[model samples]
Target: MAGGLNLGNHDIGVLAETTVPGSVRPGETISERPVDITLTMPELLRESTVTLLGGQAAEGASTDAAITLTTGGQTSTVAIPNLSSPRTDIPQQAGSPWLIPATGTVPAITVPAYAADSVALGMPKDFSIDATIHTKTTTLPAELTCGGPESLDLGSIPVSGDPVTEPTTGPTTPPTDGPTTPPTDGPTAEPTDGPTAEPTAEPTDEPGTIPVELVGSDIVAPGDTLTFSFADEWIAKKVSFELRSKPIDLGTRTVSVSGEASVRIPTDAPEGSHTVRVLSSSGELIASVPIEIEAADASDVDDTDDDYWSDDVLASAGGPGAGIAVLGGVLLLAGVAVMTLRRRAGRS
Candidate 1:
C-alpha cells in the first residue's frame, strides 16, 4: 500500500499472504510443507474480468505456490515460484474473461519443504515491487482508472512449523528470512542522494573557507563567555579575537579539534556601534562578525560610598548633600539653646 496512487479501482485490492499453525520447533528439518497461500481480493474485484496471476522470484531464493485464475469462462493455472521477491507476469490474452479463483476464491496451496539452513519464511519481509509490474497486473482490456503502474503490495502473515523446544543457547535457529536485529540505515551501503547542492553553511560558501557559528546565541554581554564553531581546517590553529571598531585584541585562542572554541569578553570592552574580528595565526584578519557590547546597567557597579566626602575625590565628589547636612546640624544646636532660656525665665 506504500506506493499505491489509487488511480485504478481503489477497491481492487489484493492481500496475498500465508498463515502458519501456532507452533514451530526450532532447529528441526521440515517435510515438504503444505501451507495455504491466499490472495484475498475485495468483493468488488470479482466484478472486473481480470485474472489474478501467480508470481516469479529473484535468483538465489525459492518460493512457490500453485495459483489458478478464472474469468467467467475458461480456467488457467500459473506458478508463483518464490514469494520472497514475489513477482507475477500476467500474459495478455484476447477474448479471455477476467478471472477469479473458483467461486471467487483460491484453493489451498502445497509448498516444497526446506532443509535446515534453507527454509522459506512464511512471511516475506521485503515485499518490494516496482512500477513496471503494473503493465502485467492491469492487463485487463476492460479495466480503466489508473493509467500508470501500481506496485501491488500483497501484505504478510506468520509461518507454521513445530513449536520450538526451550533453548539453552541463543535463538535455536537464525530466522530464515526477515528483518535484521536492527534494520539497515539505508537501502544501500552508501547514500545515493549526496549532500545538499546548496546550503548556507561552509560547504556552499567560499572554497578553502569554513563557517563561524555563534554558540548558544548571537546576543551576548561583556564578561560573558562567547562560544564559536569554525571550520575544521583551523582546528589546533591559534586565532586572535579583536573588537572590530578600531580593533582591540580581546585574546588569542586555540581552535578545538571539533572546529569549535570559546572566548570570554573582557569587562572593560567598549560600548559602541561594534563588531568582532577573528584573525588567523594570531594576527592577519580573516572575518568580522557584528556585535553590540552594551553599556553597564545601573545595578552593575556599587554606589555605597556616595554619602562619603574625602580627599579620594573621584569616589566621594561634591554635591548639595554635604552643605545640606552641615546646615541641619547648626539649626539643631540653636533650637536647643532657645528652649533652655525659656525654661530659666519661667522658674524665676
Candidate 2:
C-alpha cells in the first residue's frame, strides 16, 4: 500500500488514471490524460506524490511507468520503480500489530516550469500531467492501476516569475572581419611568357547588422514571439529571413515602416541550438544570429527528502491520512478522520 505524506492542514487532490484498459502484454504501453489541479494562495508545493495501488503481473515480470508534464513551453519526464524508492508512513495509533502493507510509490515530483507559472498568476492555470505505463517479461498480461487522488504539497511549492521575451535594438557595430583596406592593383609590371603571379581578390564582409536581437529572458517558451528589427537603411531594401532553413518573407515594406518583424517559436520545436539567417534580395547572406532552446531543467524535480517524512513533520500533520492495504491477496479498506488546517498571508 502506498502511504500519504504529511501536508500541514489544507489539502487538494486530483484523481489520476490512464486512458486505456488496465491490462497490457509485455512491452505494451498505456497512455493517460492530463490532470488539472487547483491550489490556493500561499500553498507552496515543493513536492508532489502519486500512488500506484492495484497492479498485478505474472511471476518474474517487471512493470514500470513514467510521468510527463508540459507547462510554459517546458517539458519534464519521470520514470518509476528504479527512480523511486519505497515510502513507509504507517502511523502508530492504528494498532500494536501493523496491518497496512507497503504500497508502490511514484516518487515526489517538482516541475519548475509549472512552478514558475504558478508564481506569476494569482490563481491557477491548466498544468498538464500525463502518465505513460510500460511492462515487460512473462507471457501473462500485467494489470496496473493508477491509484486515486494525486496530491501536491502546499507547504513547499517552488515559485518563480513567468518567462518573458522582449525586442531589442539591433547591434550597431559591424563585424570585425570586414576588410579595412581596399584591394590594391597588384603586379603592375607586365611579365614575359613565363606563368605570371595572379592578383588575389580580398574577401569582403557584409556591412549591415543582424536584424534580430534577443532580449528579456533568454528562456523562451513555446509560442513565444521573438521580435526582429531590420536596420533602418535596409528595411526598404527587400530583405528576408530564414530559421532552420525555412524561408520567412518580410513582405513589401514601405520607407516609413517600423522595420520590426516577429517570429513565433513553434510549440513542438526541439530543444537545442538554432540559427536564424538574414538574406538580401539576391540570395546573399547578410548576417546570422544563434539561439539556444533549453532542454527543460529537471534538477531537484525528483529530489524527495527523507527528512520531510520524518516523525516531526508527520507528527505536525497529525499522523497519516487514510490509506488502503492488501493482505493475503484480499483487499482491505479503512477510514480515518483527518484534521486539516489553513493559513492565509496578507495581500501584497
**Each model's lDDT:** 0.38, 0.34
For candidate 2, what is the lDDT?
0.34
Best by TM-score: 1
Per-residue lDDT tens digits of candidate 1, residues 1-348? 111111121222222333332322333322332222322222222222123211111111111223332322333343333332233322234432222221122333332222121222222211121111233223211111211114322221123565344468778887778565777677855565877565555554556655576667556666666777787666645577877677677765546445665666667777766777888873677677777777657576545543132224423434556433332221100111101000011100
lDDT tens readout by residue for model 2, 56-144: 21111112234444445555554333222122222223232222222233444443423333321111111111112112211211122
lDDT of 1 at 345: 12
Residue 137 local lDDT, model 2: 19
Among all windows of 10 consecutive residues in model 1, the one with the lowest summed lDDT is 339-348
List where candidate 2 sits over 4 angstroms from the true fold: 1-212, 215-218, 245-256, 295-348
Model 2, residue 152: distance off in Å is 66
In model 1, state the lDDT of residue 218.
54
User: What global local distance difference test value does model 1 have?
Assistant: 0.38
